[model samples]
Target: MKKLMLMLVSAAALTAHSAMAKDTLTISVYSFAQDAYKKALYDPFEEICDCELVIETGNSVERMAKIEANAADPVIDMAVISSHDALSLAQKGLIAPLDISKLSNHAKLYPAAQDPIGNNMAVGYTFYASSIVYRDDLVKIKSWGDLLGKDLAGQVSLPNITGTQGPLTLMMLDKALNGGSGDFSSVIAKIGEDADDIVTFYSRSSELAQLMNQEEVIAAPLGRFAWSRFKNSPLSFAWAEPEEGQAGGMNVMIMTKGNGNEELAYKLMDYWLSTEVQTRIAEALIDSPANKDVVVSDEVADNLTYGADLINSLNILSPAEIIANRDAWVEQWNAEVIK
Candidate 1:
């Protein structure tokens, strides 16, 4: 009778534990990463957990608005967002503080990328750096100064103020030509001088690509991701070595606050941070691996912005500062440059 009772209790606890292991995790990510994520992360993780994955894709503004709207009763478990967006949400207290110790692969991440903003608000996924894309056959633009030439009038493309490229390019050029190193306000003067030559400032990388393909533009500051789509083109990408170096942004993963799905979300975040996973996904997608320990094949490594010295030279901006000043910068941009 005692043996039977013990056996019955063990069986009941096992069933209860099995039931507690939720097999469904919904994640939000950029539309750009949708295909690669589905192929690499979603499929593999689902197979491992014997769970179902529901992926939602959108731009930063739309995704953030969704989270804010659903804060009280959150449906999204985990989100792959920009560090700027992460910082914005963190400031609003919409994201829960993550326990780094709980992550199975925390040690695999780049030391600087672990708690990217220093407040443990978000974890860096990958970084995007800006460079000059010019037609080698048609023009000679090796640095920021070449873009300012009157010969390229009506042929230059630029980033819209709302976009990361716009602000980063502005800062990069300012640090290059003007005496200033960090403050981007000085670069606007250079842009203002070449304003007449500037074509429409693009809000999307697609638009910038189109401009390049159509021969409506000669040179512009573009991200490393854009290079993948333009690999076969006659366009040449030159990493401009400015005094302050290249400017870039880090994409991060965020966990929403007060969500009942913290356990699953935490698990997914850990898996995403795993060096093996990062190496696998980043190589296939041409996105820079966020995990410092991740080692990729030579071909994929060539496609990415890599090498320790190069990465170290990258003057990456603080996502927190960018978000805090985003509105004001946009306003000022419109008032002065965009106008």
Candidate 2:
């Protein structure tokens, strides 16, 4: 009877441990996250763990908002977010602190993607840089200051103030202000008056390609990923080297608090940052990978910021400052720049 009782206890413990070993996980990713999940994430995980992945895709802001809404109960397991949004979620304690040591692949990531800001609340997974794309045939724009004058005046594309493009444009404008030193009130006011000169205030980077192909708009301040289509065209991107240089944001991955899948989340992140997976994702035209150990060929590496040196050189705004002053910046943009 004693032996039987001990055997029963061991059996129960084993069952419990097996139940807890489930590798299947659900991920909340941005809509744009599909390509990466397909090329870099899903198959490798599925092959190794034989576990299914359920993807929940939405905008970064909306995804973070959902995490916030479910903070008390915790519906999400893991998510990808922009660096600023990741910081915001961490500040609010909506995300779980990552157990960095568990992630052996942690040592393989590019330094820029290594949670320089969030500690372990978030980790950089990709690098994206923004610059001006122009038709070499139409305009001769070489500097950010050139944007203000008459060279490509009527055939331009810019982001509308109420959209994501609005913030991106502000970052560029701030740079154009000669590291925030150039007097830009007149330039800002002129944009509002000259709004018509802008062919469209695009909400999506994909639209820039359409407008460019149609010749309705020749130049735009575009994200690196958006340049995939234009890479071989007479239309190409230039750094535009505003006196302050270019500013960029790192895409981040965060584990949601209390979803009962910490290990699975870490494993998914490890897979995503695996050098092989990172190379594949960058090649598939998804965003750049976060793994510094991954070496990319000239093609995938051309337009993206993937390596350590480039990632470190990327000038990004502070999350606290960007979030705190966003409203004021928008207000100033509308009052001074947008009119």
Candidate 3:
């Protein structure tokens, strides 16, 4: 009958449509600002590539563990993590070197961001300046030494040794106390001596911000990326510029080893690092742009760690140094600072 013939044709069309759906591109990233990322980058990328964007979010360590566990069959097609974390993955052969030629926007990145880890395993996506965040009404943080000073005793929170901010904090504290010799033992000892005075050693910036908002703490060292939480708050807060200078670090994008999705992955990465997308992300205050061509309004710039001058001024820690010293640093930290 004519009705049966029409039904058969409709069924065939549905099957063909289902078969023609685009492939999925999986990405692992930090658990911060996903909503803004969705609006500014992910949705647009998915549309352009005609692929489903599968996002997995967590802290760096957990995501790294996931990639390592699934090494034989990668669950994540691509990722964005701290440069040091990416390097760690590279050393273990857990990630693949990016083909710069595939990323059309790769040439627009700052020279420092172009090959931060040097193995082509990753490329920088954003930079952050680290320093103290203090309640302006309650504390006067003139130097990194102020964290251990008697004035803010029992009212300060320090980043834990396991986190990125922790080592940067130690670096500044080392400079403050020992004139930047790169040895943080004395700095750890000083914190150990003042252990009881410190409110807690926080792992997440959000945790630090919460404590400050509740008045449980007056000051804590944090990354510029997290400044918006406190800056927008009803309570007064200030980002301190210490005599030792601010510490800086970069986050990078990488491809998981043998994920079998290189072309689509590169397409997404390229789009994410392009001037147009980077500018939008900067405008949303989700990240400080790594693409040098991105220009934003001053009002938007105020919320970001923008400009080459400030980036150059930062006392950046080398990813190699962090990797080489981290284990020993954590061991020393637990024995001294936590004891």
Candidate 4:
């Protein structure tokens, strides 16, 4: 009888342990800066929630595909993706509208960060400004039109039309040439006309950085997130404040539809967006804070897309506009820019 009682107690303890282990929240995130994220975010959240974070990291495209493939039964509880990507997922019914009340820090985010994708389907967590980064010693870039001017001629590079900064570059160049119209046909034709003048259409910021460091290219349009790579380079580089102003975009967080982990997901989202965490992430130079309450030193602010004055001044292209016209733009691009 004693032996049987001891066996039953051990079985019950094992079952309880298994039940506790089941408390987990799976998330999909960008592959970059995983170590920093683990230190500043993932580990702390795990400790606070007493739940494991099963992280799946990759580029936005692959992760979105996986989320779609498992739409009927979401493997990811929550994810962070570009606002346009979030809109696409929401359109496909792969993600659900957020319950803002669950996120205490929702009120703390910048107005643009709130309801960025509409219907509260997602919330912005970071903002990036895109502009020209040029070797001030070699050329002067005062306007977006200067990218194709006689001065930059063969020394400059333009972003490939397929990348995030591509449409932004087109938009600004259009503004410079035609009073800020949304139509990019003229821009594409103009770029084609000046194609030989450009060294190459770069697809990655890192690749662009390498070219710049090697003095193979002197100027290019780049997102502020990659500003550090050039700012710290041996060459003298400057972020351009063109007459047309800077183009900007946001990355957002979304909850998977019917993932049965709303409680835990919301918990993590709230914690991630809290002022403390935002400040930490900003200081680490990992992401620019969307929380308006976050404050950092001038030096840190210089390295990030910080402060309301600059954030408000940015001319952001709408996600709806991008989603609606990207296909047409791509077709035109392949025909004229690449061909």
List CA RMSD, all candidates: 5.8, 5.7, 2.5, 2.9
Q: lDDT of each prediction vs. the true structure?
A: 0.75, 0.71, 0.90, 0.90
Model 4 C-alpha lDDT per residue in residues 1-339, reported as the tens digit of each score: 999999999999999988777588999987666788999999999899888999998666678899999999889999998888898899899999999999999999999999998899999999999999999998888999999899889999999876678888999999999998889889999999999999999877767998999999999999887787788788999999999999998989999999999999999999999999999999989889999999999999988899899899898888888888888988988888789
Candidate 3 residue pairs in clash (backbone atoms < 3 Å) = none
For model 4, name the residue pairs that clash: none
Q: What is the Å distance of residue 127 in model 1 from its true position?
A: 2.8
Decide which is better by TM-score, 1 or 4: 4
What does the lDDT read for residue 172 in candidate 4?
93
Positional deviation of residue 241's Cα in model 2 after best superposition, in angstroms: 5.7
Clashes of each: 0, 3, 0, 0
Arrange candidates, best TM-score first.
3, 4, 1, 2
Decide which is better by lDDT, 2 or 4.
4
Model 3, 1-339: lDDT tens digits are 999999999999999999898899999987777888999999988778778999998777789999999999999999998888888899999999889999999899999999999978899889999999998887788899888999999999999987778888899999888999898888888898889999999987778888999999999999988887888799999989898899999999999989999999998889989999999999888899999999999998877888898899999889899899999888988898887
Task: Give me the displacement of residue 181 in model 4, in angstroms.
Answer: 1.8
lDDT of 3 at 244: 85
Error of 2 at 257 (Å): 1.8
Instruction: Give the clashing residue pairs of candidate 2, or none.
Output: 109-292, 110-292, 188-337
